[model samples]
Target: MKRKISTLLTFLILSLLIIPSSLAHDDQAKHDADLMCVFWGDDKVSLSSEEKIAFKIIANAAAITIDQYSLNPNGRIKEGTFNEIQEGLKYFGLPELSINFNDIDLNIKVSNDGKNISPNTHRLYTHLGWNYKKHPNNDFWKKRKHVLIDSVNRLLFNSKKIFSWFPWASDVVYPPSEQCDAFCAIIYYVHIIGDHIAGDTADKLKNIEPLIHYTSMDTPGIIVELKEQLQIVFQEQKNSYTFFELDQKLSDLTISIEKNCDILGFIDTAEKCKKNQEHAEQLLQILSKHLPTLLKNESFFKSRFK
Candidate 1:
């Protein structure tokens, strides 16, 4: 039973392999928040009367880039708030200004999934819990590799541990079809974890409209409460196929999305697509965990990805 549960988790772990161990970020992606605080809060950096107004305009323009991937990439005006940023830069005669914004700084000391992810999206998956040790050597990196595994235990096994980051739901927040690429990992948790029970309590998994419909993430108690519900699947074995079905659905959806979805840019290198691709690989690998017969069925499973 323990081994089966471990195998089940491996499917989830496989999906996370795409996320890099940690992203080398300058701590950007406030989702695109104005970095005014960086300069405004600095006591030593005083602005002149004229510079202050220019700063305000620049700050306002910069704020638009927070958490926004487009507003600016490569330190140049290309995407989201380009026009506004251009105006601010031109207004201040600061075309050469190196403004840093839209950095959410995901220094991922841990992955939300069961194991450490691929290095590509490491920063996207978590923040750094780096120990302030005198020796930050190979031993440190090696130890840090278990970040995702530790997260799995804390999230699923531990009852008292508190989570630091929110599982960013790409489907709800930025569905690849319309907004961004299909970079959703939260659904993996929702589908896999949500497949536990079968009665009135099981209704939560079947109907996630209420939880996903929340306008503000401030009251995300449901997400936390679901941890208790996770215990159901860990103990129950009858619903193992639920994991496979939900995982397989992802493959079908990906094919449909690629053929019909409205993608904004390139899908190959797009971070979101990269995430979705890796997650798909994990699902395909699960065709042999414990339940080899049902999963091995040629008709039941058809994931033909490159």
Candidate 2:
């Protein structure tokens, strides 16, 4: 009887141990499956190390500018547009201008002048494009776009040129701009780029040659990753109700690029700065819509470090 009791006790203990171990193993397996499911559906595809880093930098700047624009709209100046020049200064941590143009003391003596308008003030007003009496011309808008594009293009190119000239000169300028009111324009560019380009064109912009390139060149590998991600996304939703919506977004970008570049006709209104910005934005939007698929690609996660 004692021997029988001993055998029964041992069997009960073993069964308890085995059951818990099996349950634990099953739980772990379920957890891993859940992780894989999310990984395949939520992440963007992998980017090359170089492209990843550059994209991060540009993306960070673009995000900040976009967020600020959404919140403040016409930041600083209440009229006209946001100044991109100022945004660049702020991005680089520069101090704000202490002297307001209205408050500045312009010591001018009027000597029998029929027009009492001082030359300095007149010039300042004209340059600021605040004169409502002047006929609205394309020159002012083009000039504003020109100044802003130069500032952004310089910021992007300056890093490469300086590094090429002197590898030791690696002080990357933050919020780089050439004008005091440049931030507004910078914000506008970021907004447009994010809206139109899908943010992937940043990859192509990096390969451009000297003096002609508008932004830094990123690795082509990154483009591959983006294209792969976009493909997966488009394929997954090719027949969905939202496919039409995504196609419309792509169409909008195409239209914007064509208009900015004057691809439809011989429009003399094509300015490189404006067109470049429009191009950048268009690329951003195109890439953005497919970001979910890229980020979630199973292969992307598996090969992220590789």
Candidate 3:
């Protein structure tokens, strides 16, 4: 009986030690999966310049609508605000959004003195642990406020259409007839930027710096290196390289960066390195598939880098 009790206690101790580690692994895996979904969604969508401008206009209008509602004592979007969105949608020939101002119940309130208020559209502020009264005009809040506005625009205008379940299929399908708009692009952009910004200042800079360098035309670093590499690979192969070979070369470059580059200094753990590798692989595949066409538009392609 004494031996059995001792064994039982040992087993319990072992379980306690193992369970949290297993749970932590599971949590990390889920987080990576969510990130991958965002990445994949962004990669598959393409938007034209005009559509991009229209989306911006519509997004700005939506922000105005939210601000108007927040300021209104009645907690309703103004008729003018609603009309502006409709007009923008019609002008762009985009499908009409089905929101009624009367139907929205955002559960916000204003103080009697008009100085204090319940949280309105910027719920992300609360999520980030930012006290509105304390950090109202800081750069951190401003950047995140833009993200919130874009998210709200997506929620009001595009989410229902994009996320609606297909009648014949169990899964949600973005309608094929509709163009992939700002909604598709912004979701992942927001997720990645939001995730980076959630970290400490140093870590945030480390994470976002690579992204900024890759996206900005004025920044002469990773993107320029990528473009040069792409040119070299295409020139050497003369359009004869197998997709597999091209993918492998690009993967090698990214892996090299992952292992040795200071650009990814924020990736401290093996799990983060693995996740970054996977994201790089996906991006490389996109470049590989579009290599021929992208090369053909040499001037346009070169314009994307320094």
Q: Which number leads on lDDT?
A: 3
Over the stretch 179-217, how does candidate 2's per-residue lDDT look in tens digits? Answer: 213322323332333222221223222212111111223
Writing each residue's lDDT as its tens digit, candidate 1 over 111-212 gives 344343333333222211111122213343323322222222212222122322222221123212210011012212222221211112222122221121
What global local distance difference test value does model 3 have? 0.36
How does candidate 3 fare on TM-score? 0.28
> Candidate 3: which pairs clash?
none
Work out the TM-score per prediction: 0.20, 0.24, 0.28
lDDT of 1 at 266: 24
Query: Which runs of model 2 end up more than 4 angstroms from their true locations?
Result: 1-229, 232-234, 241-244, 263-270, 293-306
- Which structure is stronger by TM-score: 1 or 3? 3
Better of 2 and 3 by lDDT: 3
Tens digits of per-residue lDDT, candidate 3, 24-52, equal 11322232233333323333335454443
What CA root-mean-square deviation does each model show from the true structure? 24.1, 23.5, 22.8
Q: What is the C-alpha lDDT of each candidate?
A: 0.27, 0.31, 0.36
Candidate 1, superposed: residue stretches over 4 Å from native: 1-142, 151-241, 260-306
